[model samples]
Target: MIMSTIFPEADVTEGLKSAMRLYASGVTVITAGQGAGRRGLTATAFTSVTMDPPTVLVCVNRNGQAHDAIVENGHFCVNVLCEEARDVAESFAGMTGKTGADQFEGFEWIETRVGAPAYAFAQAAVACKLTQTLETASHSIFIGEVCEAATNPDRTPLLHFNRGFHAIGALK
Candidate 1:
């Protein structure tokens, strides 16, 4: 089977959406801040990039506020959202467009080693030190070294798929 021969790209929107739907991945809240100023956004475009030094990458929309904050702070926290965090995902995804303390209201959080706010209720939290930022057309690829990591014992990750948040059902 020649995989390259399958042609599709005329309407990239539908193709992109369809492709993403079939590839279900965990959701995350990418955050950047210091002191009293903090910004966060819901992101699923995160992945491990290296193992030797424990590095990971996150893709952020170039125009997003979180991207700008990260650029200035050179730090971030990847809070791996758990299955019960659908509301937290929605809040950060602009469902309410709440800013400042309002966005973080009612959520339990703690400071990372680098002092960035991270969600404590998450299944895992990977605190990263910004290593590099590469600019693309509409997004910036952020590479970071895992400075600190912690996991909660009883939590399943939240997954994004088909333009919605989905939790895995019981297996047959």
Candidate 2:
């Protein structure tokens, strides 16, 4: 087994990233804006915060193109990817070398009540209205109140771990 230790004076950024890669997480594409202004990005930093008001949070890099669109639109949709949507994930992640509206060219998207675009074939989609924003050094934590949601139960979620995409297998 391999382990890394962080010292007080050591830079922890790379270590932190390396450590996080071992943690498997569901993949998602967060989208915001409408029409010509639409933007989306592949992300895994999303979680449900509460059930009371159906709140959720997504962490987006402040420097990402979709970041400003999310803030200015005041809404975003978290589209949980299914295993079959790996191409969609790659496109939005800039792996296809497409940016902005181009990233959405080949996929069908539906607009939620809050005006954010949601992937039509996602495993699940949660539409949220931006309620709060907490800024960190390099990212903003977007806290949202879920306004609408949809799901495709037959599909299994896409997951990321060890720098690769994976699908669920039989239970241990």
Candidate 3:
């Protein structure tokens, strides 16, 4: 349920935003490399669209640096963060103030078919080529054709909720 009682008002958009924060989502580090080298950002708005055409979509804030980078490069890699990669997510989220090669640091990464940086230690990674871009008021939804994808069998996915990272616990 949406818990409507907490957001019952005509001008409660901010309140609804705050309430939406309670919904947990998997974290992803979306990256692209081009003349600007590599630019990426942590995101929680990625989803698979269709398996037939192997499509996936990610919503990026229109003002973010990576938003234009993805458009310029026409490709990107979705690095699904693992439970142990909270700092990685935070780093890509601009919390560290590091940019360019400095941000890559000790992470093992490689260029893929789409020329995007793929994380070697990601719980899951999907390389994609941009197919379409749909602009909404505050964000741009980028639909991509998945060119490659893989998942690590032993890792737990990282989650974001309530403006914080949550640990993944094993089910009993």
Across 20-69, the per-residue lDDT of candidate 3 in tens digits comes to 79778899999988534788899998999999999999999989778888
Q: Each candidate's TM vs. the true structure?
A: 0.89, 0.92, 0.90
lDDT of each: 0.86, 0.93, 0.87
- Segments in model 1 whose C-alpha atoms lie over 4 Å from true places: 1-8, 170-172
Query: Candidate 1's residue-wise lDDT over 43-140, tens digit each?
Result: 99998999989999999998888888888888999999998999999888989869754677778889899767889899999999899999989999
Candidate 2 has a TM-score of 0.92
Model 1: per-residue Cα lDDT at residue 98? 90
Per-prediction count of colliding residue pairs?
0, 0, 0
Better of 1 and 2 by lDDT: 2
Judged by lDDT, which candidate is best?
2
Tens digits of lDDT, candidate 2, 1-172: 6546663436577777877987889999999999999999999999999999899999999998899999999999999999999999999989999999899999999999999999999999999999999998999999999999999999998998878778887222
Q: Model 2 residue 70 lDDT?
A: 95
